[model samples]
Target: MVKIDRRWKQVVRENSQSPLFICLGEKHEVHLFETYFKYQLREDARTNDVYLIHYQDFTDPLTYGESLLAEWAEAFKSWPQGTAAWPGVDFTVTTGTDAGRPVAALAELCRLYPHLAEQHIFVQIAPTVVSDFDALRNWISDWGRAVKKGGISKLKLVLTDHHKHQTYKKAADAVRFRIETDLTAMMQHAAEFTNPKKGDPEADYQQQILIASNQLSKGNYNLAVAALEKAVRIARRQKLPEAEVTARLMLAQCLAAEGKTAPAHSEYQLAITAAGEKNLVAAQIHMNYGSFLLSQSEQAKAKTYFSKAVDIAEQIGNDFIAMECTRLLGQLSEGILTGDAEAIRYYERCLEIAREMEPEKRRQSSMPYVAGILLKKYGEKSAAGKILDEEMRTLFGENWIDLTKKPKQMK
Candidate 1:
């Protein structure tokens, strides 16, 4: 098997159970289609046979699909003499010049070979083949409905275009949850909060916040921001400072995600003011703001806020916040400055905080922190490293993956 790119492997591993994947990217440069085909071949070669179909070869959509059934049937006839049983096969179809017809072909293929839907199949479509964005979007809307209507099995559709527009964004938003387990779970949880209880005046405002969370998980930042804004307005009208602060914090997150940096910063400031300096909510706001700053490449500002948060958390005896802040600081020290002394101190404090917390509140992955410290203080071949590796293997089995290593790419 060949090595696969880290991002590609992460996607595949996380979505192993998902029936579909929609990857939208640049047409000429990204090479998302080719990379995905190679990655899937390497990842699933042991269990399933992989085939690629260039859909442009056939003029008619029905004929394009018929060829696959014919090929699949022929494979069973000329089996190797020593084979134990009939082998299963998966397919990847790519459409270039004839992108308009491939969707029909795919839907027909699914109708004929409903059994093959159980295996992972990939498809690549060239968006430029369409006349305009409207055409492309119409194609996508139709295609999405067909898939949801139980037309395809395991399909990964890669859209290669020179540039992405609103159509691409909408398509990605529609499918992101299927590709990410955490998001799918979050969406499910959010659905429970969608309806307010009868005669509960506060439930409406609370519902907005919960629904906003669902939109955020779906990557619909604009919708999330709008929901949070409505929640904040309701909270302010009710004179509920705590609820307002919570709403504002979420509003800031959505703003930041949408790349509205100035508005995000203002929202964070408003939230902090509302929570007050010594409050636990203030500490949380500081931590969240620090994370935002870190994402924006403001390390010094992030460090200052992290320090403030840790100080407040220590005063309030909130071990969870302290543990989290210290861990973040440790990551920064180790990753950015490579400052072993500071990083080790922060990590040790984090571990101490974790140990002191109640079992239910404690995070179970402290061994990785110790392993990280060992890797920094001593080389991979050192006694500490050997001990850490052996311990990790004992805990997670012999094939445990190393957290520090980058996934290999195909040469």
Candidate 2:
């Protein structure tokens, strides 16, 4: 199973004060329960005060009240009235019979022992209650209303049900559950959030774009396309310019990956126009377009776009992108224009810039172009040959020598 790391704990703790809804599958309930208990214990340790209210059996309300009243009386010597203890901490237990009657019970508790209700921390355990879709919605709405009006600091509702229903799943803020017996499969399912709903549609659309990009990274092209399409529709509906541009770019990449060249080219053009000038997206647009043009044997047009990308990258002080653009330009000019000395010069410049940069993936990516330029300059026969050989080995491992086949038409 994937371990819940410190970062996950931080996220949950930060949101602890807020209303939390949870739905747990049977297999995972124990894990969720343990985590929840840990959170409470942590908070209590920090605050130096903790109160727990058990609601499993409430056969007699008077008996429950007497126990709570005695506890409160001992905590505060003389019971104060009204809103004096409004911000203090108090945990009150309630049963399934009290699930729909939270407000009424709260009012009764307040009238009888005003201090306890003034500083209420409700721990409602409704084991026998069977909540439908409407009940779930109403429960959440009521919880929100109580917090807004009554200034309730914490409200914890624990439901003991055999089957996990969609209603509870949708209402819960974050679910804490365990995975099944297969740890790998459990971890995978745990990684997927049950709720994808966002408060704002535009924000949700942007999230979809990110999800699509992640899917693309995993080589799930069809899923990526579907996500991108949904993101585009949402962006259009919300009139979010940045999101629309991003969706277009992602769609273009998906199309290119699928080898749908004509449509991909059209999409790239749209992305370039939508991204406009003086933006990171615009720089990427130029680079992608240049790559496409180069693949189609339009070296001159591709060179112009690559140069534009280089300029933009320089303006933004993005040395990696500048190096890549410069390298690509050199490749295009050399491959299609046949040993163009100017292309060799550009490649040399890229190498110089790359040498100054930190060691990273981009630095590694630039090595091939540097080797290509050396091959162009020294005719694969001089000291340049030794440099190329060493670089290929360094970049592509020992098999590099076997894989170093010359391009059929190195114009």
Candidate 3:
């Protein structure tokens, strides 16, 4: 029996030089193929000089004759010569097949200019159903030989099929790697917050939101949106009013991130209506809604929502929320909502709250924003400079004052 582990690793390493192989069995195998090459490219830092060629063209094979190789080759040739030597590397993709046409074309070009082959890497990925396995293997062998003769360092053949093929098993040993998906990790992490002993509608709702948050962090926005929507439905079904409001607000935030402003606004409006009173979660909803409106350039509407949040924060006696509300109120007052006097009032209130908080939390929470507002609006350049310097000394105890310079505005 082949020591499958050692054999797979050896093939993976050798193929790193000129890996030509087929992936057969399951729709999952295509995802695996993509993952394997992605890992290899990232590991070797060959991201710039990696190519992916799709052979089947589309779901319909009738339109499969389009070859992108000639265009890719011409474009590669037009690039500044010797770009791939020492400082640069280029990648090219090609598709379609008239048996050995692409391989032959590449071989001829490599023979004409050996350095071009050395500097560039080529990849060919064909759907396994279209061509006979024997013919494909023979072509790969011929192409591999040509690649070796031309002194090319890397070439890869990726063949994909939905069903296991006897030909692949007979000719090539299967190499596999597990790929992590955002959805899988999210579900696993959500499971952590679940407790049968403390099970309740609120706990379930929080767990769902946590899962959605994880999905968002992983850049799976669609999944996050879906999860939030489901959480809302679950909360409503269970008659958990607070959970329903929170879920709707979370959904609004997710939609805003996706730039779906109209729907997000509608959701935020629904959340505001549902919240009904001064509550921590409701205040958060108002704050997020206000921020969203500001981002959308609805400054007047944003100010109304921010003012509501500020009132709720004060009612709840939550200084953290009050501080945030004040900071945002100050930001809005600078231009969006009101005049400079209002801006200064809000800033001063925020500064007061920040000062009253524990020193560590104050440093972490509000000093940076306060310093920024002073510099930008008050034009207290020296005072802003001094405040930032002194705060860093007292809080971070580091002379990282130079790190706080404003970024250049883009035209």
Q: Number of the top candidate by TM-score?
A: 3
Candidate 1 local lDDT, residue 297? 88
TM-score comparison, 2 vs 3, better candidate: 3
lDDT of 1 by residue, 211-257 (tens): 78767866888878888999898888888888999999889878877
After superposition, the stretches of candidate 2 with alpha carbons farther than 4 Å from their true spots are 1-199, 210-226, 236-241, 257-260, 335-337, 355-372, 375-411
The predicted structure with the larger lDDT, 1 or 2, is 1
Estimate the TM-score of every prediction: 0.45, 0.42, 0.46
For 1-411, candidate 3 gives per-residue lDDT tens digits of: 023224434555655664455545445435655555555444454334445465443232212322435545545665555244222213232323232345445555555656646544546455535445555554445545544555445555555444544445443433333322454444545565555555565666766787798787667889888889888988888877788887887788788878898998899888877777878878888888887888788888888888888899889877777887777777667865456888878877877777678876775676555656655565645776566456656765664444344322111
Candidate 2 residues 202-291, lDDT tens each?
A: 556756766686677568899889889898888778876677777987798788879897888888787777777876878877887887
Estimate the TM-score for candidate 2: 0.42
Model 3 whole-model lDDT (C-alpha atoms): 0.61
RMSD of each: 15.9, 19.4, 17.0
For model 3, where is the 10-residue window of minimal lDDT? 57-66
Q: What is the lDDT of candidate 2?
A: 0.58
